[model samples]
Target: MNERLLLDHLLVRGPASRADLAKITGLSKPTVSAALAGMEDSGLVHLAGEVLGRPGPVTSLYDVTAGAAHIGAVDIGRDWIRVAVADLRGRFVGRKDGRNAAKNSEDLVSRVRELAQAAAGQAGLPWTSVITAVVGSPGVYDKDADRMIFAPNLPGWEGSGLGDRLRTALGVDVTIENDINLAALGEHAYGAGHGIANFALVSIGTGVGMGIVVNGELYVGARGAAGEVSFLPAPEPVPADDDTLRHGLTESLAAAPGVVRAARAAGLHLDTAKEVFTAAAEGDPAALEVVHAEGRRIGGLIVAVASVLDPELVVLTGGVGHNLALLGDAITSRFAELGPLRPRVVASTLGDSGVLLGAVARALSQAWDHIFDLRQSGVQPRQSGVQYGMSR
Candidate 1:
């Protein structure tokens, strides 16, 4: 029913000849020619050359122009606000970072505008050239309510319309999502989950989060809060300890803050999670024990994920995930002990840019639809080829 989807269906199936495009989309040859011509003239698509099978002149091949549009991706983490300028092809042309999003959404909006303006200048385009912006946050962002529902870790973000603020400041539409959702989609599109049937992206950072992709699509559970693993209860040594109850149950115990607390009790003056990890690398026995224990705890967590979803692999990302060498074998040995049923664990391929790239990818996907929709003829249905086999 939707022509835009039809055109995209053709574009995704690989470059097609005009006749083949018509055949694939069930559009008349003349209609296909008109659509292709319109798209090429607008600079949204270009000719890639021709086919030898056709008699007379070679047919022209068409491809979507990547630079014709762009998306601004922003990641508002605890310490820094990372922004990236990326084209439709998901290539990041520029990047910039500023202070954290803080308690106030207004400050974040201003910073985003400044960075978006800078990124557009860097890309040799105007702000309007950016189709949309995606902001990834640690909190639960309620899209319809236009508010960040439950983010105690972020002080001034409770009743903010982050999307509206950024859209207003930058003069472009904006979308906000859980940072893990962005990272999960990123891994699925360009990282370890590329072509994998089932995969999970687990990030160990200032907090723990996860993004899940099942059957080749991101699984965003109801209420957009699917992968909130940080609050899942962990086993506590002292059953009746109120302080232990506040620290989180299970998954939170191995997060960055949790690791710091564990190290400090063992006499390490660690100001950040990085220090705790560094101590472990240098064979500080207390730090080593704390980190390795965390690793085993993480492994147990993985067992739950694997058993529930049975993803093909689990990708670990962020500062803590990248330092798997120091976290000890408790994770690997424990997971391995789960036998083949335990999903294989590997480090994230995208490093810190995983969420940034993902936000860019989401923006690009949205823009791709817009670009194709404007071309009009891309939507008309075309015919399909039939192959004859040995008939019974």
Candidate 2:
């Protein structure tokens, strides 16, 4: 069984020949064969046909059955809910995200349920075929307590049974994490930080947040608030006689509110930063200045982060991350001026779904651990999704 688990890992992580799987798992050819036979019987593994070999019969390769299991990822934000159904191999089967502010916490939960169902339907799965579901919430959390500590965006999120409710409603093991943290994890596992040992994900949007990956592990931090970089005060003091426009910190200056506020000051009355960015992208001079100034705010922080953490990469993501084309030069120039230990600065690779993608990855990781750990603990694996009529 242990050899079988090792063989499973080999097939899932990468396509491998039986010899390679035996070498990696430290098993004999017969042991590998027995494990492969079992996995094949279970529909979890299949041969990739013959690989050309040198002066010998073709060697067969084995790979995972990616469609055998599926995962669900949900992103719950102040103004929207995004849901995606991803196959076992991390291929996006289907997705849906729409901008609709929840009237209250109940409405938010209901909307997420609706979106998850819709996503699964689009993916051609039964209403509940997901093995695990991970959610991206708007605030910090204490996973130990299954409690949200401070999620200002989701009014009734913290100090409640939202996790329990979500798990019950979705009929899957539910895990919730901050969107920015999930974004960082997503990038680490599948995006830009595929092999880096250390990095930071600086998300600039409705709020500014950072996620640190140290020694190839996501740094959850003391109290789970390690990367709330927006709360960091500005190094330079506010000028005594300056306009109110000059905020204390760089993130407030660079973040969405700051940009929209600056645009409004420049004779643009955009209620949301979306309006500001739209006008800015369409060649509005006032909106352009807002983006430029927003760059200055983000630039200083980027330099500060680079100098402090000295990570290998710093990726900017979120709603505002897309505007890097408009603001990249100014921010990069400022960062270079300030740092000797500057890291690579890049925009998001996976677009706005980076966080949701990360959530999916996180859920998959947990499911992976659950597969091994529960057996060791003499506990049966809980069925991840609604088991159709089987459970009922």
Q: Scored by CA lDDT, what does every candidate get? A: 0.74, 0.75
**How many clashing residue pairs appear in each of the predictions shown?**
13, 0
TM-score of 2: 0.85
Question: Residue by residue across 35-86, what tens digits does model 2's lDDT show?
Answer: 7775665555688677885677788888876776678899887777899998
TM-score against truth, every candidate:
0.84, 0.85
Error of 1 at 192 (Å): 0.4
Number of colliding residue pairs in model 1 = 13
Off by over 4 Å in 2: 1-14, 51-59, 234-252, 278-283, 336-341, 373-392
Worst 10 residues of 2 by lDDT: 381-390
Measured by TM-score, the strongest candidate is 2
